[model samples]
Target chain A: MTNVLVLFGAVIFPFVVGYILISRVPQLLHTPLMSGANAISGITIIGAMLIAGREGGNFGYLLGMIAVVFATINVVGGFLVTDRMLQMFKKKGNKNPQE
Target chain B: MEISLSAIGFAHLLAAGLFVLGLRFLSSPTTARRGNMLAAIAMLIAIVATFLDRQIVDFTSILLAIAIGTIIGAFSARLVKMTSMPQMVAIFNGFGGGASALVALAEFQRLSVQAQLPLPVTVTTLLSVLIGAVTFSGSMVAFGKLQGLMHGAPITSRLQKWLNIFLLLVVLVLMFLIIGSAPSHALFVILTVVALIFGVALVIPVGGADMPVVISLLNSFSGLAACATGFVVGNNILMFAGALVGAAGLILTQIMCKAMNRSLARIFIPRQAIQAEKALHDASGGVSESSAAKSDNKPQIDPLAAAVQTLSAAKSVIFVPGYGMALAQAQFKVVELANLLEKKGATVNFAVHPIAGRMPGHMHVLLAEAEVDYDKLREMDSINPEFKNTDAVIVVGACDVINPSATEVENTPISGMPILAARDAKSIIVCNYDDKPGYSGVENPIYQDAKTICLWGDAKDTISQLITSFSG
Candidate 1:
């Protein structure tokens, strides 16, 4: 049953990712599109998550921990980076005082 | 250790849902920010789940690593300027490629050392290595050029095209034999390096004029590589996502090519006589445009007087802005002007061309930032009809895109490209700092039109004066 669950995860995860990439990505950007995508791809922590939860060797668990930290950095780091870039545009947006 | 696919699957699904919605929202400048936010949210969810799921042996090291990366990423992002966003994007893209490449190469080393890799594994592994290496190097060259660390002109010389063909042959031969039977890892490494150089050569020669399109095309290549990597790893999510990106990027590349009136092959053509011929034509025609300015006879109207007339003269006005508009930081004032015009019972519309400004829908984003109504912003196809009904088309700080040269000039970079035909309007008033032609160095004859008028100055100041001229 757990194997079935794992298989289901593998099948469904791709569909979800596909939905995001196909129907959603093309709407607003192209130039800076890859940066956002790259930032998102740092989600390898999920792989680490599986490795971590599994009853693995001590070294395997250590490897999983390292991977999770890297993944977390990517996520939080990506958002902060994006916000910072957005700020520069905001500052230069327009000359209107009301705005 | 046993991996539970079900829990991870549900998490991936939710994350992917967010990713899709984020992408959809990004399509319109109106929703671009929201889309970015949604995507960010999805990333957050993905990261958090992955983090929590990991087995915690010693939490201190994990927390420290997270802390260090967060500080660095946040700091770097904050420090980067909007003007340099393109370069930053390239760098980030290179990182993804490099990471994937390193992963594939390391895995190959791991498997090779074990002295036995199945046929399927070997093939998938090599494909991943090849794609990743190419993407990594190509993206770095792109970043270097965009960052001004390298030249923007196409770096071409005689027989460079033939050289590329030879390189491709070597790369293919190397790929075929190595995958069939494992070779010395050192030889394979060298082969990968050579292919990486070829990737750099392929992109470095492309001119800055075609940058937006090149960026899209290279992006598609990267996505395709990612898909191959996913196959190697048996990661369905990576494959699906990569396919989506590849398809979208390819479509964008096509649209960009069409917009420039250039073929895909033209982008890769090296040291060809066709380009030389085009340059010759441009230089010959340029001499006449500078000399043709009608001297001293025509009456130049003051902006205030023009504004008063503009307010009273027409029922409908279409404002067409370009890269100049963005540079001027005048969108807010333009918004104000639009509002005033609307209040005075004049219908106002924004005409946006597909390839206008520096990127696709460039002016649209600037205007949306000014809080302009989304409905009022119209694409080229939709607004052409409105131009017929329009009494005035006030073109602001724009060039190239609106230049009649596209329709009239032959062999020019933008020849045969569609434009707004703003010159056809009953009254066309262009507010710009320069009477010169745009990007391709070709001259625009629109300034010579009988009804055409040029109000020259810095765009923001001129538009600000127009706002004052209108309010008073």
Candidate 2:
């Protein structure tokens, strides 16, 4: 159907663009880039939120709650860890700490 | 007030655009933090939009779960040591994968109550369950290997290949049965169980050294699982972001495979099988001559004293750090030594190999944490050509990256893997734990070379000694 075709197009578009952009990330930032990408994959939290907040049985809501918790941890932990790493990279300066 | 589906769709489209820009900003370190912030903001937008969906009737439980997750996630991120970063990433990946699986299961439960499930929804639900379960369990195995909770060596069995194949066949058959008839809870549960086992089987035979490739592959699997869930839930943003991450993980896996000079399949197929064939070849060849030479070449000079003399007289030096350096916790001492050498009128640079630490860019982060100037950290290709012109090369707890046998030997696990040109340096000082084969288990011939000085011991003690001797 047209709906399937449109969804496929959406998926392909982001994937191609992401591949082109991510391939250029230098070796120096590979770890941060990976952690950052992992965080982005936590977009599953959106699906979790819908399931959790839906008008469903107690068990369904509980399942959704657990999913939300897990996805949020991945999203939050991944980004913050990546930031902590990015903060460490400093260019050479005259006031060399080691010197 | 009810929100329109088109309004939510518009918000998702905007978030997707921001996600692309966020990744684009990661091309350089200067813009990377802003990129991360951008992506974080995108996530916020998506979450807020989801909360406004008309189907969402309850708010208290979801908000409470977010708070719990936030506290735990923030504390772990803020408290984890940089050295344990690979494990941290692996565990977080597991959480993401598990969430996707849970979402699919919840949706299945909600849909199963209906009279009939659409074929497309049923298919997507099955795919999500399979991929998500595998990602979750595979990542846990990776985390355990990296964190030393389990043996870091490849755990293989004679029947592993057969078992994995059988499991795949069973899963396929189950899919057919479920699609052929009305889906049942038991069939889905069985499929999830099989997929989880398959994940463990897929990663267990991989050695710790191959964890970077495995972790990246699992990241890709987690993304694909999310994409499948998106199809099940009919969510556009989930599909878009998931595909983006999936592509990113695959690209990283490809890069790692190239850097390590390994075929994609080699990471999973146990190296023991390859080594067995190599052993047969070596037994019939002139292998004993090399062993004899190695034994006769054992330490002839006081390498530590020689190392100190070379440090004092050298005008140019290159420092190579490997996983061993990280293991020895010698980054700070290494910086101290580099400073001493510099003060003594010697130029110093740190050569980082692409596969240097447990994961990609691991060594760079550790060196940066030790306050080493980013400019001084040269990547393998960029620094390799300079090794020959350098006067002294100080290898701190590194072995495989600079091993000559990788290029010199044939039919070995690391044969043809590009190595640092440390052998080309005029004088080499190695402060390592031992002259044993590294993670690849291939004997390094460079240690026995006449121009190389091996100061074998704990890297921290050895480096501290160098600092003291050079400063004095």
Candidate 3:
């Protein structure tokens, strides 16, 4: 029972902090913010690593391997795309390499 | 072993702290790029710490899978056009959800191979599977709609709401069975299948124009699914990061819903009230006819020529862009025109509607990609009152955002939705595909205003013509 309460507390703590922090994000960077947050959600890869890297390489290994791939794609793709967009947003006369 | 566990816990704590700090910096433009880097570093720390776990023995397969994913992910991210970023995000969200679901499934499989699982594990695993599958399939449908692979209009069946209810009931029953008795593998598989179908059902009825809200909600679901998986696997880092993502997505969703003046429920299950409202407004058509008649009293002059004349005389200009600008790929030309106007000694600004384009901040991103100075872009609320003082407004492939009917009419599809006050400007130049109603299916009356010039054609061609005529 105590473990469950701690788990719930863990979830709630970040949720409230994220809410307060993200609400302050301006409308200008919403797309990048969303994609960046999406990338961080790929933290599930840690759990996937545990499953796939376990001693017994069986059915669970296959599922875990696939999970790792999916999570990696989300993390790598999400962050890069977000960066690509953030790089585009510039003030007047500021240097943008893509230009 | 005890010492190593404690060290790993400490590393995870540090990573979580960095993640929070990273998200905090992401809120501002000046530090956003650095924020992304921080988050990436935090991810690295978490992964390395996880590597120190004693249970991890097979690094070869894990490394290979990550390599494959990294190559595919990096290539897609690099090659995707700026305009297609929404679709790219949707697909990435799908993969994240799919991964979380798979993790939960693997853990459940490993546990079920032994005796009956604990009640907590059983519940969390089921929750993860259900929510993750829904996010995964729902995001794919969103991707298809955004990518033009599927129709953008709302696709519904006669029993759409009822079917969703039935699916929910079935899922509940399945979950109850798993919880009530022993955790059966076959039952779990059935539950996963049902959840996946429910996901498709949930998102398909939402129109493409409402995709911003749907995408944000699905993004939230993906995070919550990860959180559930964290609970199932007893991982603190996953839970913390997932919850943060959940919160971020919800905040975005709330903002989008408010910007569009739409209720979350109405976005998912649209009513026939809008059609009835449209019928009522169409019956009372005096407002539109009067405006049209008033416009007819002006001396006969070509709209494009009049627009050019207005542009030449105006000392202040505002540009309003929408999804049509994206479809026509006219951001560069629009920017070119804005620059030309500025060079002609006109004060220029961009009036960006909150719900403009396909996603939140979509128009700003497109304009930024075209090298428009971010300082020139103004949010709707701040720019609404300035429209009255503006000498001329250039609306590029936009309609609903500038539609006067949204405010004038009651209970229509877009009634009460905040709009860019383009009608308040002295001279309006609309470069739209046609004078047709926008995605809202409500006719825009501002096109018939006496001071408005409707240049009906592709925005790219029309904007180029404006630039050429102005330059010559």
Candidate 4:
């Protein structure tokens, strides 16, 4: 019963809330917004970590280790790249002309 | 290791709240960086909490994997150019999906070997692996097209639609079979392989012009796959984050589809069919071929001298940029030209189409990277009316967005699509490599307009030449 409820909440609730949240965003920030969301999807890192830390033998450990590597890349890379892109949107007075 | 499950759950709830706040802030530009920081912090909290969970039995390997991943991630994110952001995002999406699929596969294998597989766990595991595999392979194809490693044009045949449908059915049947029986590792493996192929098939028929939509859709798939992984692992924070990403990505995809004046259903139809139909219409003389043929004889001008003269005389000019500007790395030159024009007492502004570059807000990001003033960049609706009163419009490496056929011609590929009214300006100067048709395979008649001057060369070369001439 709990599983069904959790699955329902996971699938449907976020869709409703996320639609409302994203609708307010202007078109100019859409790319950064997508990148930011891409970063958030890296939440799979949690599951990957759990698997890696488990004593699931050699093959399982190998898969978990790779998963960890990939998820971390998504989290670290996604956030930093998004920040780099957003940094470019500074106001005229605050602009860094060097880049 | 001291934190209890409930405590971890509470932390996840708080993290989820921060993510929502982060997205809210990201809706606007000024606070977007702070929003990104907030989300990053939230991710940090989630990771740290997971590491502290009692279920963890090994740390050395996990930490080592994280170290390796961090080095690659930070380096690529820091080093990649702003113009190639879409390809970078695609690659990242692929990695995320691949990770989710691998986690699910590992968990399923462990459970099946232990004879402890439950129905719900089994279902979610199958789903995560399938969606994740597809997202992984599909995003690779998207990255290939964007990076020019593969042709940007859609590769499809008449049998593509049927083949995709058949493959989808096979995967579905295999999924049910796995779910119905004891965990058959071989069946799961086959399902993953089929799903991966299906992902490649799904993206191959999509043309480069529609890459933004493809990227957005793939982004959503990666999120949903993560959500399924969360279910398999029984992690609340992972589930919430996945849902958030899935929802946001879908909305973005819809917005991109709307901006292109294309229905989501129409976008999935192979581009070859659309092109073939248009070809048949053209052959039957449905639209006048005279203008297309006459384009070969259109007068070409000395772009540098003509652009300098035009800038010198014009009191107000609007610059329209497209994917070609990004392709040629000409955004900095465009910014320089705009600065020079502003100094000459001619007001300069950028007219940005919503779908102008490879992705949503692509031109805005490119110009922003070039340090173009935010106020000087205007959206399609706001700038369309101003074009008629504008003295000169300089088109930089753009085609379809400024194509007059979008507004003038009927029953064509780009008809009724919103475009900049560059044709209404006093004079139009186009800087591109050649007078070839744009991505839609439709010949642009604007190049043949008497007042229009074609400057055939790379955008960077031509724009810099104009800047030099203006300085002289």
Model 3 accuracy (lDDT, Cα): 0.89
TM-score of model 3 (CA atoms): 0.96
Query: Can you list each candidate's DockQ?
Result: 0.21, 0.81, 0.81, 0.78
Candidate 3 chain B has its poorest 10 consecutive residues by lDDT at B283-292
lDDT of 2 at A29: 89
- Interface CA RMSD, all predictions: 5.7, 1.0, 0.9, 1.1
Model 2 agreement with the true structure over B1-472: per-residue lDDT tens digits:
4347877988898999999999888768789989998999999999998887888888988999999999989999999998899999999999999999999998998888776789999999999999999999999999999999989988888787788789889999989987876768899899899989989999988887788888888888888889888998888899999999999999998989999999877788765656744643563243423534655766555677889888888999999999988888899899989988888789999998888888888889998888887889898889999999999999987787898777876777877889999999998998889876678776666777778887888889999998888766
Per-candidate TM-score against the hidden true structure: 0.77, 0.95, 0.96, 0.94
The models' CA-based lDDT, in order, is: 0.62, 0.87, 0.89, 0.86
Error of 1 at A61 (Å): 14
Chain A only: give the TM-score of model 2: 0.85
| Alpha carbon deviation, residue A65, candidate 2 (Å) | 0.9
lDDT of 3 by residue, B290-386 (tens): 5366457766788879999999999999999999998999999999999899988999999988888777788988999998888888998889999
Ten contiguous residues minimizing lDDT sum, candidate 2 chain B: B283-292
Provide chain B TM-scores across all predictions: 0.82, 0.94, 0.96, 0.93
RMSD, one per candidate, in order:
5.6, 2.4, 2.3, 2.7
Candidate 3, residue B25: Cα displacement in angstroms equals 0.7
lDDT of 1 by residue, B389-469 (tens): 687888887777787777776766667888886776777777787876665666667666656666777778877777777
In model 1, how large is the Cα lDDT of residue B238?
A: 49
Which docking class does model 2 fall in?
A: high
